[model samples]
Target: MRAVSLVPSLTEAIARSAPGAVAGATDWCTHPPDLDVVRVGGTKNPDTGRILSLAPDLVIANEEENRAPDLEALREAGAEVLVTEVRDVPQAFRELDRVLDACGVPSHPRWLDEAEDVWSSLPPPATRRTAVVPVWRRPWMVLGRDTFAGDVLARLGVGHVYATHPDRYPRIPLEELRAAAPDVVVLPDEPYRFTADDGPEAFRGLPCALVSGRHLTWYGPSLAEAPRVLGRALRAARP
Candidate 1:
């Protein structure tokens, strides 16, 4: 079964589980490091013409990472598109299984099972700190309401202020976020590349935990190491 994955996480899972199954992948699908699929383009702006030329039987995408117009265009050209929505850990697990099955894999990849085991085995934290997790800056966008990253942090006993907000990823003014006065500002490496020197300097006094975007955001093999890796980062920045 030939597949084109627009989501990086799915691309990794598919490539890892059944090698050579992916005919094309977005430029951002960088997992497996040695993935040799045809580079279609970015997740948000994939080259639909390039994807179509690959003649994939199945095209996998995420509701959040991929745009609707591109999916529609693929559909209009008679390509079968499987769109997955993963708002939380449980949903992610289910979606991953569904995606693999659609790709003709007989069962869940070993890494997928390992990912679930690790999350279920996570110990409770000593304190559940309320944080403001920012995904982007320069007109800052934050994880607000029903985000997978928020749920991942929630599993780690980290509470975020925007979990109750109406919008999923609301763009709040810098002043408003400062007014929120969260215990720490959690920054992920992707979506913005929040490094120790770059992101922390912005919030003069507040503590910032520079977390891995792949572990925090992507829902695939990285799920296995997220608890340990993210826990360490959060612990190092503990107030």
Candidate 2:
């Protein structure tokens, strides 16, 4: 079955589970290092013409990562679109299973099993701390309300300071975020590519944990290592 995957995590899952099933993917679908599918476009702005030209049997997308108009256009053009909504770890596993089954993968992949095992193996948190997680700078967008990253951090005893905010991603001023006085400030390396030299300076007084964006945000093979990777980073964070 020929499939076009707009989400990078789903692309990797498909490629790893069913080697040659994917026909096209977005330019951002960078996993599987050797993936050679047709480049349709970006997640927010996929090239509809290129996607239709590929004539894929199915297309995979995420509710948050993809635009509704693009998905509608693909469906209007007679493409079978499968949209996934994963807000937490359990949801991610279930949705991955459903997507893989729809793609004709006979059994659960090793990575999925490993991811479940990794998360399950984690002991209860020894300490709990409120953290401010910044996904972007400049305009200063932060993780708020229900988010996959917030859930992941919560599992590791790190709760988001803005998790109760009305918006899923809220744009707040830097001064306001600092004034929130979180126990720690977590920064991921994507969307804004926050680095030690770049991001840590802003929160000089707070303990900063620089984490991998792929492990923190993506919901594919990275889930298997996220618990350990993020756990270590959070543990090592110092004021």
Error of 2 at 203 (Å): 0.8
* Runs in model 2 lying further than 4 Å from the true structure: none
Q: Which stretches of candidate 1 lie over 4 Å from their true place?
A: none
lDDT of 1 at 80: 98
lDDT tens digits by residue: candidate 2, 67-183: 999999999999999999989988999999999999999999999999999998889998999999999999999999999999999999999999999999999999999999999
lDDT of 1 by residue, 44-103 (tens): 999999999999999999999999999999999999999999999999999998998988
Worst 10 residues of 1 by lDDT: 196-205
Candidate 2's TM-score reads: 0.98
Give all candidates' CA lDDT scores.
Answer: 0.91, 0.94
Flag clash pairs in model 1. Answer: none
Summing lDDT over every window of 10 consecutive residues in candidate 2, give the lowest-scoring window.
230-239
